[model samples]
Target: MFCSGCGQALAAGQPVCPQCGRPVAAPPPPAVPNLAFEVANYANRVRALSTVWFIYGGLSLALGIVGLAFANSFLNGGGFWMHGPWAHGNFPFGPGFGSAIIHFAWVMVVLRSGLALVAGWGLMERAPWGRVVAIVAAFLSILKIPLGTALAIWTLVTLLGYRNTSLYDQL
Candidate 1:
Protein backbone atom coordinates (compact mmCIF):
# COMPACT_ATOMS: atom_id res chain seq x y z
CA MET A 1 0.00 0.00 0.00
CA PHE A 2 1.00 3.65 -0.22
CA CYS A 3 0.98 6.33 2.47
CA SER A 4 -1.67 8.71 1.21
CA GLY A 5 -0.24 11.73 3.06
CA CYS A 6 3.34 11.62 1.66
CA GLY A 7 2.78 9.26 -1.23
CA GLN A 8 5.53 6.97 0.17
CA ALA A 9 5.39 3.26 -0.58
CA LEU A 10 4.47 1.13 2.44
CA ALA A 11 3.88 -2.49 3.34
CA ALA A 12 0.23 -3.47 3.00
CA GLY A 13 -0.37 -3.54 6.73
CA GLN A 14 1.95 -0.70 7.78
CA PRO A 15 0.27 1.68 10.29
CA VAL A 16 2.36 4.73 9.50
CA CYS A 17 4.66 6.18 6.88
CA PRO A 18 8.40 5.31 7.25
CA GLN A 19 9.52 8.32 5.17
CA CYS A 20 7.45 11.14 6.82
CA GLY A 21 5.94 9.33 9.84
CA ARG A 22 2.48 10.20 8.66
CA PRO A 23 -0.29 7.78 9.49
CA VAL A 24 -0.79 5.25 6.73
CA ALA A 25 -4.48 4.92 7.46
CA ALA A 26 -6.69 7.89 6.76
CA PRO A 27 -7.28 10.15 9.75
CA PRO A 28 -10.86 10.70 10.79
CA PRO A 29 -12.41 13.97 9.73
CA PRO A 30 -11.88 16.79 12.21
CA ALA A 31 -14.89 17.56 14.32
CA VAL A 32 -16.37 20.98 13.63
CA PRO A 33 -17.46 22.66 16.82
CA ASN A 34 -20.66 24.65 16.88
CA LEU A 35 -19.72 28.30 17.01
CA ALA A 36 -23.13 29.64 18.02
CA PHE A 37 -23.52 27.06 20.74
CA GLU A 38 -20.08 27.85 22.09
CA VAL A 39 -20.85 31.55 22.22
CA ALA A 40 -24.13 30.88 23.97
CA ASN A 41 -22.37 28.60 26.41
CA TYR A 42 -19.85 31.34 27.12
CA ALA A 43 -22.66 33.74 27.81
CA ASN A 44 -24.25 31.25 30.16
CA ARG A 45 -20.96 30.81 31.96
CA VAL A 46 -20.65 34.58 32.39
CA ARG A 47 -24.12 34.71 33.85
CA ALA A 48 -23.30 31.88 36.20
CA LEU A 49 -20.18 33.68 37.31
CA SER A 50 -22.31 36.71 37.97
CA THR A 51 -24.28 34.68 40.50
CA VAL A 52 -21.08 33.48 42.10
CA TRP A 53 -19.83 37.05 42.34
CA PHE A 54 -22.99 38.07 44.13
CA ILE A 55 -22.66 35.20 46.56
CA TYR A 56 -19.03 36.04 47.27
CA GLY A 57 -19.85 39.72 47.67
CA GLY A 58 -22.66 39.02 50.08
CA LEU A 59 -20.48 36.70 52.10
CA SER A 60 -17.74 39.28 52.28
CA LEU A 61 -20.17 41.95 53.39
CA ALA A 62 -21.57 39.73 56.11
CA LEU A 63 -18.14 38.78 57.33
CA GLY A 64 -17.03 42.37 57.32
CA ILE A 65 -20.00 43.36 59.40
CA VAL A 66 -19.23 40.61 61.84
CA GLY A 67 -15.61 41.66 61.99
CA LEU A 68 -16.59 45.26 62.61
CA ALA A 69 -18.85 44.17 65.43
CA PHE A 70 -15.97 42.34 67.11
CA ALA A 71 -13.22 44.81 66.25
CA ASN A 72 -13.57 46.89 69.42
CA SER A 73 -13.09 43.92 71.76
CA PHE A 74 -10.26 42.49 69.69
CA LEU A 75 -8.21 45.66 69.28
CA ASN A 76 -9.21 47.82 72.24
CA GLY A 77 -8.66 47.63 76.02
CA GLY A 78 -11.58 45.27 76.49
CA GLY A 79 -9.64 42.02 76.23
CA PHE A 80 -6.89 40.71 78.51
CA TRP A 81 -4.41 43.25 79.84
CA MET A 82 -6.70 45.97 78.47
CA HIS A 83 -7.08 47.40 81.98
CA GLY A 84 -3.36 47.25 82.77
CA PRO A 85 -1.16 50.36 82.79
CA TRP A 86 0.98 48.59 80.20
CA ALA A 87 -1.97 48.67 77.78
CA HIS A 88 -0.75 52.06 76.55
CA GLY A 89 2.68 50.59 76.04
CA ASN A 90 1.09 47.64 74.30
CA PHE A 91 -0.76 49.95 71.92
CA PRO A 92 1.25 53.07 71.20
CA PHE A 93 -1.80 54.55 69.55
CA GLY A 94 -3.52 54.12 72.92
CA PRO A 95 -7.29 54.66 73.14
CA GLY A 96 -7.54 55.45 69.44
CA PHE A 97 -6.02 52.16 68.33
CA GLY A 98 -9.32 50.35 68.66
CA SER A 99 -11.14 52.99 66.61
CA ALA A 100 -8.45 52.77 64.00
CA ILE A 101 -9.01 49.07 63.76
CA ILE A 102 -12.75 49.55 63.39
CA HIS A 103 -12.14 52.07 60.62
CA PHE A 104 -9.91 49.66 58.84
CA ALA A 105 -12.51 46.93 59.09
CA TRP A 106 -15.15 49.24 57.72
CA VAL A 107 -12.93 50.14 54.82
CA MET A 108 -12.34 46.51 53.99
CA VAL A 109 -16.05 45.72 54.22
CA VAL A 110 -17.01 48.58 51.95
CA LEU A 111 -14.30 47.95 49.40
CA ARG A 112 -14.78 44.20 49.10
CA SER A 113 -18.58 44.25 49.10
CA GLY A 114 -18.72 47.22 46.73
CA LEU A 115 -16.46 45.61 44.16
CA ALA A 116 -18.30 42.32 44.29
CA LEU A 117 -21.69 44.00 43.88
CA VAL A 118 -20.46 46.07 40.96
CA ALA A 119 -18.85 43.08 39.22
CA GLY A 120 -21.93 40.96 39.72
CA TRP A 121 -24.23 43.57 38.24
CA GLY A 122 -21.96 44.28 35.31
CA LEU A 123 -21.48 40.63 34.46
CA MET A 124 -25.18 39.90 34.64
CA GLU A 125 -26.02 42.73 32.27
CA ARG A 126 -23.03 42.08 30.00
CA ALA A 127 -21.87 45.68 30.41
CA PRO A 128 -18.37 46.58 29.18
CA TRP A 129 -17.35 47.68 32.66
CA GLY A 130 -18.36 44.28 33.96
CA ARG A 131 -15.33 42.61 32.38
CA VAL A 132 -13.01 45.17 33.96
CA VAL A 133 -14.64 44.74 37.37
CA ALA A 134 -14.47 40.98 37.05
CA ILE A 135 -10.75 41.13 36.36
CA VAL A 136 -10.20 43.32 39.39
CA ALA A 137 -12.27 41.02 41.56
CA ALA A 138 -10.27 38.02 40.31
CA PHE A 139 -7.00 39.69 41.30
CA LEU A 140 -8.30 40.70 44.72
CA SER A 141 -9.91 37.35 45.34
CA ILE A 142 -6.52 35.65 45.11
CA LEU A 143 -5.57 37.19 48.45
CA LYS A 144 -8.34 35.27 50.17
CA ILE A 145 -7.29 31.64 50.87
CA PRO A 146 -8.57 28.36 49.36
CA LEU A 147 -12.00 29.04 47.88
CA GLY A 148 -11.12 32.55 46.83
CA THR A 149 -7.97 31.34 45.13
CA ALA A 150 -9.88 28.77 43.12
CA LEU A 151 -12.58 31.27 42.17
CA ALA A 152 -9.99 33.84 41.15
CA ILE A 153 -8.13 31.38 38.96
CA TRP A 154 -11.30 30.23 37.27
CA THR A 155 -12.45 33.82 36.79
CA LEU A 156 -9.15 34.74 35.17
CA VAL A 157 -9.22 31.76 32.84
CA THR A 158 -12.83 32.28 31.83
CA LEU A 159 -12.65 36.03 31.30
CA LEU A 160 -9.14 36.33 29.88
CA GLY A 161 -9.51 34.10 26.84
CA TYR A 162 -9.39 35.75 23.43
CA ARG A 163 -12.54 34.02 22.32
CA ASN A 164 -14.24 34.91 25.59
CA THR A 165 -13.30 38.54 25.15
CA SER A 166 -14.79 38.55 21.69
CA LEU A 167 -17.83 36.85 23.10
CA TYR A 168 -18.14 39.52 25.78
CA ASP A 169 -17.88 42.24 23.17
CA GLN A 170 -20.81 40.73 21.39
CA LEU A 171 -22.90 40.54 24.56
Candidate 2:
Protein backbone atom coordinates (compact mmCIF):
# COMPACT_ATOMS: atom_id res chain seq x y z
CA MET A 1 0.00 0.00 0.00
CA PHE A 2 1.01 3.65 -0.33
CA CYS A 3 1.82 5.82 2.67
CA SER A 4 -0.51 8.79 2.30
CA GLY A 5 1.48 11.27 4.41
CA CYS A 6 4.88 10.91 2.74
CA GLY A 7 4.00 9.26 -0.55
CA GLN A 8 6.11 6.22 0.34
CA ALA A 9 5.44 2.58 -0.47
CA LEU A 10 4.46 0.14 2.30
CA ALA A 11 3.89 -3.55 2.52
CA ALA A 12 0.25 -4.59 2.18
CA GLY A 13 -0.07 -5.77 5.81
CA GLN A 14 2.35 -3.32 7.41
CA PRO A 15 0.88 -0.91 9.93
CA VAL A 16 3.46 1.81 9.41
CA CYS A 17 5.76 3.24 6.81
CA PRO A 18 9.23 1.79 7.13
CA GLN A 19 10.98 4.62 5.30
CA CYS A 20 9.40 7.56 7.22
CA GLY A 21 8.61 5.59 10.38
CA ARG A 22 5.06 6.83 10.62
CA PRO A 23 1.90 4.95 11.32
CA VAL A 24 0.30 4.12 7.97
CA ALA A 25 -2.60 2.04 9.13
CA ALA A 26 -5.97 3.72 9.33
CA PRO A 27 -6.22 3.53 13.06
CA PRO A 28 -8.86 5.57 14.83
CA PRO A 29 -8.19 9.28 14.72
CA PRO A 30 -6.67 10.78 17.81
CA ALA A 31 -8.76 12.49 20.45
CA VAL A 32 -10.14 15.98 19.93
CA PRO A 33 -7.33 17.83 21.73
CA ASN A 34 -4.29 16.13 20.17
CA LEU A 35 -2.15 17.01 23.25
CA ALA A 36 0.30 19.28 21.51
CA PHE A 37 -2.40 21.43 19.98
CA GLU A 38 -4.24 21.56 23.26
CA VAL A 39 -1.18 22.81 25.10
CA ALA A 40 -0.41 25.37 22.45
CA ASN A 41 -3.97 26.57 22.20
CA TYR A 42 -4.33 26.90 25.95
CA ALA A 43 -1.08 28.78 26.23
CA ASN A 44 -2.20 31.12 23.50
CA ARG A 45 -5.51 31.78 25.23
CA VAL A 46 -3.73 32.51 28.50
CA ARG A 47 -1.46 34.97 26.81
CA ALA A 48 -4.31 36.75 25.11
CA LEU A 49 -6.24 36.97 28.36
CA SER A 50 -3.20 38.26 30.15
CA THR A 51 -2.85 41.07 27.69
CA VAL A 52 -6.46 42.03 28.11
CA TRP A 53 -6.15 41.91 31.88
CA PHE A 54 -3.17 44.25 31.89
CA ILE A 55 -4.77 46.73 29.57
CA TYR A 56 -7.99 46.99 31.52
CA GLY A 57 -6.35 46.53 34.87
CA GLY A 58 -4.11 49.47 34.25
CA LEU A 59 -7.10 51.67 33.47
CA SER A 60 -9.04 50.46 36.48
CA LEU A 61 -6.05 50.98 38.77
CA ALA A 62 -5.58 54.50 37.49
CA LEU A 63 -9.20 55.33 38.14
CA GLY A 64 -8.90 53.97 41.63
CA ILE A 65 -5.92 56.21 42.21
CA VAL A 66 -8.04 59.14 41.12
CA GLY A 67 -10.58 58.19 43.70
CA LEU A 68 -7.89 58.07 46.35
CA ALA A 69 -6.62 61.47 45.33
CA PHE A 70 -10.09 62.86 45.63
CA ALA A 71 -10.45 61.51 49.12
CA ASN A 72 -7.10 62.95 50.08
CA SER A 73 -8.14 66.41 48.92
CA PHE A 74 -10.98 66.36 51.45
CA LEU A 75 -8.42 66.19 54.28
CA ASN A 76 -7.03 69.67 53.52
CA GLY A 77 -10.02 71.17 51.81
CA GLY A 78 -10.96 70.34 48.22
CA GLY A 79 -8.32 71.28 45.63
CA PHE A 80 -7.66 69.75 42.22
CA TRP A 81 -8.81 66.38 43.47
CA MET A 82 -12.03 68.07 44.59
CA HIS A 83 -12.67 69.45 41.14
CA GLY A 84 -16.25 68.75 40.12
CA PRO A 85 -17.00 66.87 43.34
CA TRP A 86 -20.65 67.59 42.77
CA ALA A 87 -20.39 66.16 39.26
CA HIS A 88 -18.86 62.93 40.59
CA GLY A 89 -21.23 62.94 43.54
CA ASN A 90 -18.39 62.77 46.04
CA PHE A 91 -18.32 64.51 49.41
CA PRO A 92 -15.08 66.33 50.14
CA PHE A 93 -12.85 64.62 52.71
CA GLY A 94 -15.49 62.33 54.12
CA PRO A 95 -14.10 60.15 56.90
CA GLY A 96 -12.33 57.03 55.61
CA PHE A 97 -12.93 58.06 52.00
CA GLY A 98 -9.28 58.25 50.96
CA SER A 99 -8.36 54.87 52.37
CA ALA A 100 -11.48 53.32 50.98
CA ILE A 101 -10.85 54.60 47.46
CA ILE A 102 -7.26 53.48 47.49
CA HIS A 103 -8.18 50.04 48.73
CA PHE A 104 -10.93 49.66 46.18
CA ALA A 105 -8.64 50.52 43.28
CA TRP A 106 -5.89 48.25 44.49
CA VAL A 107 -8.39 45.46 44.83
CA MET A 108 -9.46 45.86 41.20
CA VAL A 109 -5.88 45.63 40.01
CA VAL A 110 -5.25 42.58 42.13
CA LEU A 111 -8.41 40.87 41.03
CA ARG A 112 -7.73 41.18 37.31
CA SER A 113 -4.01 40.54 37.44
CA GLY A 114 -4.38 37.66 39.86
CA LEU A 115 -6.90 35.91 37.64
CA ALA A 116 -4.65 36.31 34.60
CA LEU A 117 -1.62 34.99 36.41
CA VAL A 118 -3.58 32.03 37.71
CA ALA A 119 -4.96 31.24 34.29
CA GLY A 120 -1.52 31.27 32.73
CA TRP A 121 -0.05 29.14 35.48
CA GLY A 122 -2.90 26.68 35.39
CA LEU A 123 -2.67 26.32 31.64
CA MET A 124 1.03 25.61 31.90
CA GLU A 125 0.24 22.85 34.37
CA ARG A 126 -2.44 21.42 32.06
CA ALA A 127 -5.24 21.96 34.52
CA PRO A 128 -8.60 20.88 33.11
CA TRP A 129 -10.29 23.98 34.50
CA GLY A 130 -7.89 26.47 33.03
CA ARG A 131 -9.77 26.85 29.78
CA VAL A 132 -13.06 27.21 31.58
CA VAL A 133 -11.60 29.88 33.81
CA ALA A 134 -10.14 31.70 30.85
CA ILE A 135 -13.44 31.73 29.02
CA VAL A 136 -15.32 32.96 32.06
CA ALA A 137 -12.77 35.64 32.77
CA ALA A 138 -12.81 36.75 29.17
CA PHE A 139 -16.58 37.09 29.30
CA LEU A 140 -16.48 39.08 32.53
CA SER A 141 -13.82 41.33 31.08
CA ILE A 142 -16.33 42.51 28.52
CA LEU A 143 -17.79 44.81 31.17
CA LYS A 144 -14.97 47.27 30.54
CA ILE A 145 -16.93 48.91 27.72
CA PRO A 146 -14.84 49.82 24.68
CA LEU A 147 -11.74 48.10 25.98
CA GLY A 148 -13.85 45.21 27.14
CA THR A 149 -15.37 44.98 23.67
CA ALA A 150 -11.93 44.67 22.22
CA LEU A 151 -11.02 42.00 24.74
CA ALA A 152 -14.20 40.06 24.07
CA ILE A 153 -13.60 40.19 20.34
CA TRP A 154 -10.05 39.01 20.67
CA THR A 155 -11.15 36.15 22.92
CA LEU A 156 -13.81 35.13 20.43
CA VAL A 157 -11.18 35.02 17.72
CA THR A 158 -9.00 32.78 19.82
CA LEU A 159 -11.87 30.43 20.58
CA LEU A 160 -12.87 30.28 16.94
CA GLY A 161 -9.34 29.57 15.88
CA TYR A 162 -9.08 26.72 18.34
CA ARG A 163 -12.42 25.24 17.27
CA ASN A 164 -14.89 23.24 19.36
CA THR A 165 -13.16 21.19 22.06
CA SER A 166 -13.45 20.29 25.73
CA LEU A 167 -12.05 22.29 28.63
CA TYR A 168 -9.54 19.50 29.26
CA ASP A 169 -8.34 19.55 25.67
CA GLN A 170 -7.83 23.27 25.91
CA LEU A 171 -5.26 22.87 28.69
Candidate 3:
Protein backbone atom coordinates (compact mmCIF):
# COMPACT_ATOMS: atom_id res chain seq x y z
CA MET A 1 0.00 0.00 0.00
CA PHE A 2 1.04 3.63 -0.60
CA CYS A 3 1.07 6.26 2.13
CA SER A 4 -1.56 8.97 1.50
CA GLY A 5 0.52 11.82 3.04
CA CYS A 6 3.96 10.97 1.60
CA GLY A 7 3.00 8.79 -1.38
CA GLN A 8 5.66 6.31 -0.30
CA ALA A 9 5.27 2.52 -0.49
CA LEU A 10 4.48 1.03 2.91
CA ALA A 11 4.52 -2.51 4.22
CA ALA A 12 1.15 -4.18 5.04
CA GLY A 13 -0.29 -3.43 8.53
CA GLN A 14 2.33 -0.71 9.18
CA PRO A 15 0.82 1.93 11.44
CA VAL A 16 3.12 4.77 10.42
CA CYS A 17 5.39 5.71 7.57
CA PRO A 18 9.03 5.15 8.57
CA GLN A 19 10.51 8.19 6.78
CA CYS A 20 7.62 10.75 6.98
CA GLY A 21 6.19 9.84 10.43
CA ARG A 22 2.67 9.90 8.91
CA PRO A 23 0.05 7.51 10.28
CA VAL A 24 -1.49 5.17 7.73
CA ALA A 25 -5.22 5.16 7.71
CA ALA A 26 -6.82 1.76 7.91
CA PRO A 27 -9.20 0.89 5.08
CA PRO A 28 -12.82 0.84 6.05
CA PRO A 29 -14.38 -2.58 6.55
CA PRO A 30 -16.75 -3.87 3.88
CA ALA A 31 -20.44 -3.48 4.53
CA VAL A 32 -21.16 -7.17 4.51
CA PRO A 33 -24.55 -8.60 5.43
CA ASN A 34 -25.98 -12.07 6.06
CA LEU A 35 -27.20 -12.33 2.52
CA ALA A 36 -27.15 -16.10 2.34
CA PHE A 37 -29.59 -16.45 5.25
CA GLU A 38 -31.89 -13.80 3.86
CA VAL A 39 -31.86 -15.39 0.43
CA ALA A 40 -32.69 -18.78 1.91
CA ASN A 41 -35.59 -17.32 3.85
CA TYR A 42 -36.97 -15.67 0.76
CA ALA A 43 -36.60 -18.88 -1.23
CA ASN A 44 -38.51 -20.85 1.38
CA ARG A 45 -41.30 -18.30 1.41
CA VAL A 46 -41.56 -18.42 -2.36
CA ARG A 47 -41.77 -22.20 -2.35
CA ALA A 48 -44.51 -22.14 0.23
CA LEU A 49 -46.44 -19.53 -1.71
CA SER A 50 -46.13 -21.61 -4.84
CA THR A 51 -47.49 -24.63 -3.03
CA VAL A 52 -50.42 -22.64 -1.73
CA TRP A 53 -51.17 -21.39 -5.20
CA PHE A 54 -51.20 -24.92 -6.50
CA ILE A 55 -53.62 -25.98 -3.80
CA TYR A 56 -55.87 -23.00 -4.42
CA GLY A 57 -55.83 -23.65 -8.15
CA GLY A 58 -56.72 -27.29 -7.67
CA LEU A 59 -59.61 -26.43 -5.39
CA SER A 60 -60.91 -23.81 -7.80
CA LEU A 61 -60.67 -26.28 -10.70
CA ALA A 62 -62.60 -28.86 -8.74
CA LEU A 63 -65.24 -26.33 -7.81
CA GLY A 64 -65.59 -25.32 -11.43
CA ILE A 65 -66.01 -28.89 -12.48
CA VAL A 66 -68.67 -29.43 -9.87
CA GLY A 67 -70.50 -26.26 -10.88
CA LEU A 68 -70.39 -27.25 -14.52
CA ALA A 69 -71.75 -30.65 -13.67
CA PHE A 70 -74.58 -29.08 -11.67
CA ALA A 71 -75.35 -26.71 -14.51
CA ASN A 72 -75.44 -29.57 -16.95
CA SER A 73 -77.78 -31.51 -14.72
CA PHE A 74 -80.05 -28.51 -14.28
CA LEU A 75 -80.25 -27.95 -18.01
CA ASN A 76 -80.91 -31.63 -18.67
CA GLY A 77 -84.23 -31.73 -16.78
CA GLY A 78 -82.68 -32.59 -13.42
CA GLY A 79 -81.91 -30.95 -10.05
CA PHE A 80 -83.91 -27.70 -9.64
CA TRP A 81 -85.89 -28.37 -12.76
CA MET A 82 -87.32 -31.56 -11.26
CA HIS A 83 -89.42 -29.61 -8.73
CA GLY A 84 -89.46 -25.93 -9.73
CA PRO A 85 -92.13 -24.29 -11.86
CA TRP A 86 -89.37 -23.77 -14.42
CA ALA A 87 -89.84 -27.44 -15.23
CA HIS A 88 -92.83 -26.43 -17.35
CA GLY A 89 -90.77 -23.76 -19.18
CA ASN A 90 -92.28 -20.96 -17.07
CA PHE A 91 -88.98 -19.28 -16.28
CA PRO A 92 -89.23 -15.51 -15.87
CA PHE A 93 -85.91 -14.85 -17.63
CA GLY A 94 -87.15 -16.70 -20.73
CA PRO A 95 -85.68 -19.89 -22.18
CA GLY A 96 -81.88 -20.41 -22.20
CA PHE A 97 -81.15 -17.28 -20.18
CA GLY A 98 -80.25 -19.27 -17.06
CA SER A 99 -78.15 -21.58 -19.16
CA ALA A 100 -76.22 -18.66 -20.57
CA ILE A 101 -75.59 -17.30 -17.09
CA ILE A 102 -74.40 -20.69 -15.89
CA HIS A 103 -72.08 -20.99 -18.87
CA PHE A 104 -70.57 -17.60 -18.21
CA ALA A 105 -70.04 -18.34 -14.54
CA TRP A 106 -68.35 -21.67 -15.24
CA VAL A 107 -66.14 -20.09 -17.88
CA MET A 108 -64.99 -17.44 -15.42
CA VAL A 109 -64.22 -20.07 -12.82
CA VAL A 110 -62.17 -22.07 -15.29
CA LEU A 111 -60.23 -19.02 -16.39
CA ARG A 112 -59.39 -18.00 -12.86
CA SER A 113 -58.31 -21.51 -12.00
CA GLY A 114 -56.15 -21.66 -15.09
CA LEU A 115 -54.42 -18.42 -14.19
CA ALA A 116 -53.72 -19.62 -10.66
CA LEU A 117 -52.26 -22.84 -11.96
CA VAL A 118 -50.04 -21.02 -14.40
CA ALA A 119 -48.80 -18.66 -11.69
CA GLY A 120 -48.00 -21.56 -9.39
CA TRP A 121 -46.17 -23.41 -12.14
CA GLY A 122 -44.13 -20.38 -13.03
CA LEU A 123 -43.12 -19.75 -9.45
CA MET A 124 -42.22 -23.35 -8.80
CA GLU A 125 -40.10 -23.44 -11.92
CA ARG A 126 -38.48 -20.09 -11.17
CA ALA A 127 -39.30 -18.83 -14.64
CA PRO A 128 -38.28 -15.34 -15.76
CA TRP A 129 -41.90 -14.20 -15.84
CA GLY A 130 -42.85 -15.98 -12.63
CA ARG A 131 -42.89 -12.96 -10.36
CA VAL A 132 -45.06 -10.89 -12.66
CA VAL A 133 -47.53 -13.69 -13.23
CA ALA A 134 -47.70 -14.42 -9.51
CA ILE A 135 -48.32 -10.77 -8.72
CA VAL A 136 -51.16 -10.61 -11.17
CA ALA A 137 -52.68 -13.79 -9.79
CA ALA A 138 -52.38 -12.51 -6.26
CA PHE A 139 -54.20 -9.33 -7.15
CA LEU A 140 -56.97 -11.23 -8.84
CA SER A 141 -57.30 -13.61 -5.88
CA ILE A 142 -57.52 -10.83 -3.32
CA LEU A 143 -61.29 -10.61 -3.56
CA LYS A 144 -61.88 -14.33 -3.31
CA ILE A 145 -62.31 -14.04 0.47
CA PRO A 146 -60.85 -16.17 3.32
CA LEU A 147 -58.18 -18.55 1.97
CA GLY A 148 -57.62 -16.72 -1.27
CA THR A 149 -57.35 -13.36 0.45
CA ALA A 150 -54.84 -14.72 2.90
CA LEU A 151 -52.76 -16.28 0.15
CA ALA A 152 -52.86 -13.09 -1.88
CA ILE A 153 -51.68 -11.00 1.03
CA TRP A 154 -48.88 -13.39 1.84
CA THR A 155 -47.82 -13.59 -1.77
CA LEU A 156 -47.80 -9.83 -2.20
CA VAL A 157 -45.82 -9.26 0.93
CA THR A 158 -43.24 -11.95 0.29
CA LEU A 159 -42.65 -11.09 -3.37
CA LEU A 160 -42.88 -7.30 -3.16
CA GLY A 161 -41.68 -6.48 0.32
CA TYR A 162 -38.42 -4.68 1.17
CA ARG A 163 -35.24 -6.16 -0.33
CA ASN A 164 -37.35 -8.64 -2.30
CA THR A 165 -36.52 -7.08 -5.66
CA SER A 166 -32.85 -7.88 -5.20
CA LEU A 167 -33.62 -11.27 -3.80
CA TYR A 168 -35.79 -12.15 -6.79
CA ASP A 169 -33.19 -10.86 -9.17
CA GLN A 170 -30.68 -13.21 -7.63
CA LEU A 171 -33.13 -16.09 -8.06
Evaluated with lDDT, which candidate comes out highest? 3
Over 1-171, each residue of candidate 2 has an lDDT whose tens digit, in order, gives 788889897777798887888887686677786768766666766566655555555666566568656654554345555566442335476645655765676676668756655555554455666556666766777776887677766755554443434434545
Model 3: CA > 4 A from native: 1-33, 79-81
Clashing pairs in 1: none
Compared with the true structure, all predictions reach lDDT values of 0.83, 0.62, 0.85
lDDT of 3 by residue, 1-171 (tens): 998898999999999999899999979898776888778887888888889899999999998899788776676445543777666344678877667877788889988999999999988887869888999999998998998899899889888865887897777
* Superposition TM-score, candidate 3 onto the true structure: 0.72
Q: Residue 18 of model 1: what lDDT?
A: 90
Stretches of candidate 1 above 4 Å error?
A: 1-33, 77-90
Candidate 2: the clashing residue pairs are 74-93
**Displacement of the residue 142 alpha carbon in candidate 1, Å:** 0.7
| Residue ranges of candidate 2 with Cα displaced over 4 Å | 1-93, 160-163, 167-171
What's each prediction's TM-score?
Answer: 0.73, 0.47, 0.72
Error of 3 at 120 (Å): 0.5
Candidate 1 per-residue C-alpha lDDT over 23-134 given as tens digits, one digit per residue, 9 for 90 to 100: 7776579887777778888999999998998998998899888877776655664666466553533566676766777888798789988998899999999999999999
Considering summed lDDT, which 10 consecutive residues are worst modelled in model 3?
72-81
